[model samples]
Target: MPELPEVETVKRSLERLITGSAITDVNVLFPKVVKSHTPGDFKASLAGCKIKSLARRGKYLLVHLSGDKTLVIHLRMTGRLVYLEEKDDLPRYAHVIFYLEGGKRLVFADMRKFGHINLIPTAQLKNMPELKKLGPEPLGKEFTVQYLQQELRKRRTKIKALLLDQTFVAGLGNIYADEALHLAKIHPERTAQGLTGSEAAGLHHAIIKVLEQGIKNRGTSFSDYVDGEGNIGTNQYQLKAYQREGEPCSNCGTIIERKKVAGRSSFFCPQCQSSKR
Candidate 1:
């Protein structure tokens, strides 16, 4: 799953590659990938539209077209957007190809076929279910310590579960959540209500710091994530938690441990993060 950093990286890459280019054609190799309308309608709606800009909200990519229709893409698990100078052989998983005017092609490929694309009217974008439900972005100004405390106070869910909740804090997925929690020295199993104001403040800082660093590192390429240039991210090399199951903790030298929290694998050092609530 490409979280905020990964999605942000892709948005930047796509913006550079496809902005101002006209979509001369759209080939939907997988009909299931088009959600807003039939594949024909989706293709017709975007064929001649010029891509004005590319932006991101939460984990969704927003490609703003000239006529105010937004192309929304969620690279759910294994999806990637690659920019090619020329089409020779489409990747085995290429599901959607947007033919550009200059012979360039923007390809969306998903090996697992879980990604989705929707052509939406920009006027209705704010009210769309996905964007409407997202909380303030952790990297944005609205996500302050006071705001985080308000959202977490009295919430009985585990801290990790609360962080993973899209409505609780937008743009966080498994990797960054565990990294933030580990940085804050908070146990994933601890209830949100158990956190003190200082703890919340620490978490507030941790979230922003880790997200900024993730973006700087081009996002963690734990799986099949890549930028528009077909480049694999190298942030996996800098991970403090998330997959170093039995390795020694970088900060305290305690053995890094893994457990299931909120049905997602959590990585942390037991010594660094106290589980006692």
Candidate 2:
């Protein structure tokens, strides 16, 4: 699953590639991928619409189109978007292809078939069930330290689990959550409400720092993730704790360990994040 940084990278790349290009036609080979509207309606609604901009909220990609419609994509697990010339062969998993003007095509390929596409009126996007319930974007101005502290203080769930909750802080997934917690030196199993003021502040800073670094490095590409241009992300090489189990911690030389928390693998340095209470 691509987290915030990966999604944001895709957004940026797609913005550069497809913005202002008109959708000449839409082919939905996998009807299930069209979540909101019927396949016929989805194709009809998108045909000839020009892409205005691309943005991301939480883990969803927002493709703003002409005439006030927004195409929302959730690239669950194995979805990949690539732009290719019409003469190029479509990838084997290509499920949705947006035929654009000037002989170009934007393809959505998902091997796992778990990804979804929704078309909603731009005005109604904010009230849609998917976007409406999402919490503030972690990098956005609304996600302040005081906001994080207030949200965390209300939860008795383990700090790791709380961080994974989308309503608590949007755009954090297992990989980034582990990285952020390790950087903050906070144990994954610590109760959220038990965090001291300093710990909360540290965590707030760590989350932003790791996410910004991840974006700068393109994003962690541990699986089938790639940018719109089919390039791998560089952030995977910079990871410190996630997937570094039994390796030396970069800061204190403590052995990095992995444990299951809330049914997800969490990586941390035991010596660095020892229970402080």
lDDT of each: 0.91, 0.91
For candidate 1, what is the TM-score? 0.98
Q: Report lDDT (Cα) of residue 146, candidate 1.
A: 94
Candidate 2: clashing pairs of residues: none
lDDT of 1 by residue, 190-263 (tens): 99999999999999999999999999999889879888887878889998988999999999999999999999
Ten-residue stretch with the least lDDT total in model 1: 83-92
Tell me each candidate's RMSD, in Å, in order: 1.0, 1.1
- lDDT by residue for model 2 (40-149), tens: 89999999899999989999999999999999999978898888876789987999999999999999999999999999999999899878889999999999999989
